[model samples]
Target: MKIKAIAAAFAATVLTPFAMAEDQSDWALVIHGGAGVIERGQMTAEREAEYRAAMHAALDRGEAVLEAGGSALDAIEAVIHGMEDDPLFNAGRGAVFTAAGRNELDASIMDGATLNAGAVAGVTQVRHPISLARAVMERSRHVMLQGEGAETFAIEQGIEMVPPAWFFTERRWASMTRSLERLGLDLPERPEGAPELQGVDHGTLERDEREHRFGTVGVVALDSDGNIAAGTSTGGTTAKRWGRVGDSPILGAGTYASNASCGVSATGTGEYFIRLTVASRICALVEFQGLNLQDASDQVIQDELTAMGGDGGIVALTPSGEIAWSYNTPGMYRARQTAGGDPVVGIYGDED
Candidate 1:
């Protein structure tokens, strides 16, 4: 009897912690600021700390909702709202200026449970384009609204609107100026007249591409109810012309989710992502080929996109609380938190 009782107590002791851990949470969340050529040499410790804090704050926003039994869509959207308000990332306030010396923002959100999505492109007046995207998903019959029409829909929905100048920051303005100078063009005086975006010469796109760098913000989440969602937001490419829009506002390119597959949110060169359908392709691999989330993402980012010389990455999550990511560039600004794990944020390849 003594030996039996001792064995039972041992079993209880081993199982108690596991039970507690399992009960702590069943949800997971991941986010990415952007991915491309980030190096330790480029950032000071203080700046890296700030990026870490910003990512943690965004994670907290989503984790709080998931822990409180909210849906995946609600949690991911809330996290993106935090990112859009911060100037350190390129989504809303910090969006890059176009060749026309204006800011055009794009955003999209998807619900995995229903595969329903909404997006907005070339919207200059909306304060938080993600929320406007949600409003489109829930309120409108259309899947996407673009340009001035998107703005009109946003205003009619009573969403908070901001002036176009509200998106301008000194940093972005400087970037615009630098881009123009690289192409041997003069910077246009903002608020005075439109920029001379026409006939800017050819070798400029490669130069402008190097100057603008890359940035977009994205999130993927798994809720307590086993539902999933994904979202992405961005200021279009720097010095872009003719109302150029990126993958951020495209449902399958920047964001995709499916309860049967996985939720994927990508950050990279928007043009490449658009051509590849990066997000949905990852989900499709999971759903059709029966690969796990990590394997599917790895195959896509490492094999397919890499073959095309694309540089980018994705933060992907499965409904069962699995987290996975892949990037071909030097690094990817990424973070992830699971049911019983603390948050982990990384800016470089080695950090993960």
Candidate 2:
């Protein structure tokens, strides 16, 4: 009888690990385009459908990577690359213009397992700033690079560079001109070969105001190996002046990830996000405050950020495979998908 009891105990021990592994999450991903004053009646049906399609495309790219056993870092990079190329969301090609009529981009990426991160700012000629940010994290001992120095580094790494004109779009140019006029600031010269503007439609401009007020693109992912990663890319703000830099390239402010905590990527008013260290704060809440990813996101964005008059939102993923996002704005372009699951998307605050 004693021998039989010992054998049963050993069997239980052997099966325990397998049970835990079965319960563990395989992989998960989340993404966000910008967030602000978006409301139901503000956007035309055609425009809203386009945004939904774009979100789905970004999700497909990231889902493919995670499903293929790729690292969390790789999954997020793939997602951001698609958005940066899509003219619908402001990041790379669709970046909003600064007061000086130049498109100065910024981006950052983080590795949760290693706590390694990289960032770049004011990169005018690089075609894909997110790639440059990763190169900074991998190639150099530095965490951040900027402006002329960043462009030089891109050249050394053989990343694609395009003329500043490549970033120009008629809608962005018109937005900048209107903003400058509102602030009584002088307009800068148009980019070479820019199309002549008759007049931007008032409805179109209003829709864009809500959508692009805090324009940025970001992604966070948890992979099959239980690692997490987060990244963000942006063009600062429209009509920004004097070499302004937003939170997008600041590690803890705009982007943060940790295997022990959660990965976070934020889009909103840069100054407010920077002041609160929004991304890191959200993770800290989950790690130390004993809150889940969803509640932690709410505390920072819906409660604290809103109290401070800040507007924006964030996408987050925990090591255990929880995906969450919270925005004080009326709408934010976002989506999520888990391994072997169909993509789920949300735009308005009412979505689950």
lDDT of 1 at 190: 80
Model 1 ranges with Cα > 4 A deviation: 1-25, 191-212
Worst 10 residues of 2 by lDDT: 1-10
**Model 1 pairs whose backbones collide:** none
lDDT of 1 by residue, 144-255 (tens): 9998999999999998898887787666776777778877876766833333334433343343234236678999988877888999988977788878888888988889
Candidate 2: segments with Cα more than 4 A from true spot? 1-22, 196-199
After TM-score superposition, what is the CA distance of residue 135 in candidate 1 from its true location, in Å? 0.4
Model 1 residue 346 distance off true place after TM-score fit, in angstroms: 0.8
In terms of lDDT, model 1 sits at 0.79
